[model samples]
Target: MSAPSTVLVTGGAGFIGSHACAELLDHGYELIVVDDYSNSAPQVFARVQRVAGRFVGAVYELDIRDRQALSAVFDRHTVDAVVHFAGLKSVGASTRRPAEYYDTNVGGTTALLRTMHEHGVHQLVFSSSCSIYGEAGALPLDESVPARPTGPYASSTWTCEGILADVCRHRPEYTVVCLRCFNAVGAHPSGLLGENPRGTPDNLMPFLAQVAVGRRDRLQVFGDDYPTPDGTAVRDYIHVMDTVDAHRVALDHLADGPGMRVYNLGAGRGSSVFDVVRSFSRACGRPLPYEIAPRRPGDVATLVADASAVARDWGWRPSRGLDDMCEDAWRFQRLNPYGYEGSARRPGADRRSDGGPPIR
Candidate 1:
């Protein structure tokens, strides 16, 4: 198999996509980014620009659903592979808007694959999720675990895996790698980019950041009565940089023609709500304010990764620790106080661009 000389990153302006774009750039891969700005900002392009050290890639404000637009970008760029990160990913939002979730996550992937086929682009690296293993009745989850997606968000990811499988089976020339990512926390070391959840964050790290930034009142410790060492739910919180590192390895797997593979990208460790809060406190040198509330509906007791597969297959491992995750998240939150609401910070506040607040 030949190396992927050029690449296309879908949803490249959003949180994960943006970081992946920077990683790809550092590796000297020619890049083309596609995003609709539905949940990000145009300023992200500038951020990626800084990460790249030059304006070498193109950014198209196009949605994946628009096949013509996607095809046009492919026609304009000589793309050798695709890293698909374009999809709706909120669990609660997915329940409220199931059809939209299916359309964007599942339908958009179908469209992207068709466009890739028409454009003669065969290699792909998909961003899957551990949510597919809804209630992992066990401690560590491996790639062979049965998927039981409890919500539309998880269902959508599983559906895409099935789509890729069918696409690969039908086209012998096509190659694909699906990465099942655990909870991705933390920010880039440069602090130039990070997880930018638009609305009130649903994840733990963002919520902690909000408390640290004084945007929210206090952290709500959900379900303190769970059957665990801490009596609260524990999760495998892998750093975003580590997740990006796995993407690098997955891309290499495809570039090196290792055939189709699925790997769980994680730290192989667990951090409870209290553990995260303590880490943040240590990182910022301030105790995070919090309250213990009933476990939110559908909360899992314990969910961590059996990261042995990826480590064995690609020789990859997470380098960042929990404290590192806290520090980076704090940096991003400290840099952007308002959480990209696009509202002015305050009377006579400084604004970066006339572009306005971030879109959710």
Candidate 2:
């Protein structure tokens, strides 16, 4: 039999990336995980191995922007495809450091794509965000919706999409699927791996989980004066597992032919901030304390998904609900209050600080 297809997963030790690694392994794909652990803990790989019940083919603590290093990985391993998830993903942080966002998100993607072209590995599934669709012109934002990204993070993502589209236009051999994901919440059902943001959590679910577990004093509700019924922002919160599954399906689609496509991955539903708080309260067995604050800059009133395109094309649908998201996330938080650090024997240990030189 031919060898199992080896998929190189950038940021493989990260939140969604780790889950994707497990799912890929379960589906019988060989994995080469590359992570710098800049915003992730090293122990996540161990947890991922536990979940997958097997050893990953290789693990490189390298940044994707390191073209020489990334090329080395391509040379050493026969990477059939890449699930590109290596980039900074924080709206507030991106706003603070626009240059970093552009350099890492756009520049890193350029480096990876260049190396892929050199190695003749042409299939890619990119981790894009719904943030690319700024204030949507219509509800249930679909793939056709024009992207008017607001902040640096969204702009970088849009730029990366453009880069991929251009590559596909010229190189018909490159198969690229940009999965524009909605708010990715929840942990794996095993509770072994989950969202573990560094410093303070940026997203809703992790922040709420921290509040429920008393990591923070209380939750800070961003705003409560929007036009929605609850007057808070509304979002299509998709379970992280569902989001990872979309990657699998997209990779499968690539086998058919070389082309560039974009699909919104969401639950096709919206829930207000208050709804999430209420749901988490039920999950935590008590109401979580929060104080409303001024609206965050670049905040939108409502952002849901019209994921019919992905569903119709790939036969993918979100099976988990809001409650399922809350319960699993809470379980992860409760199990490890300090995220991976809480249980990690060597909390900050890394094999190498700099990614080192590319392997010969």
Which candidate has the highest TM-score of all?
2
* lDDT of model 1, residue 88: 85
Candidate 2 clash total?
Answer: 0
Best by lDDT: 2
Instruction: Please give, for residues 256-319, the per-residue lDDT of candidate 1 as tens digits.
Output: 6534678888898888889999999888789999999886654678879999988887778899
What TM-score does candidate 2 reach?
Answer: 0.95
Q: Give the TM-score of candidate 1.
A: 0.92
Residues 15-97, candidate 2: write the lDDT tens digits: 99999999998888998888887888767877888988977778887778888877877877888889999999998889889
Task: List lDDT for all candidates, in order.
Answer: 0.82, 0.87
What's the lDDT for residue 154 in model 2? 92
**Candidate 2, position 53, lDDT:** 94
Assess every candidate by TM-score.
0.92, 0.95
CA deviation > 4 Å runs, candidate 1: 256-259, 339-360
User: lDDT value for candidate 2?
Assistant: 0.87
Error of 2 at 54 (Å): 1.0
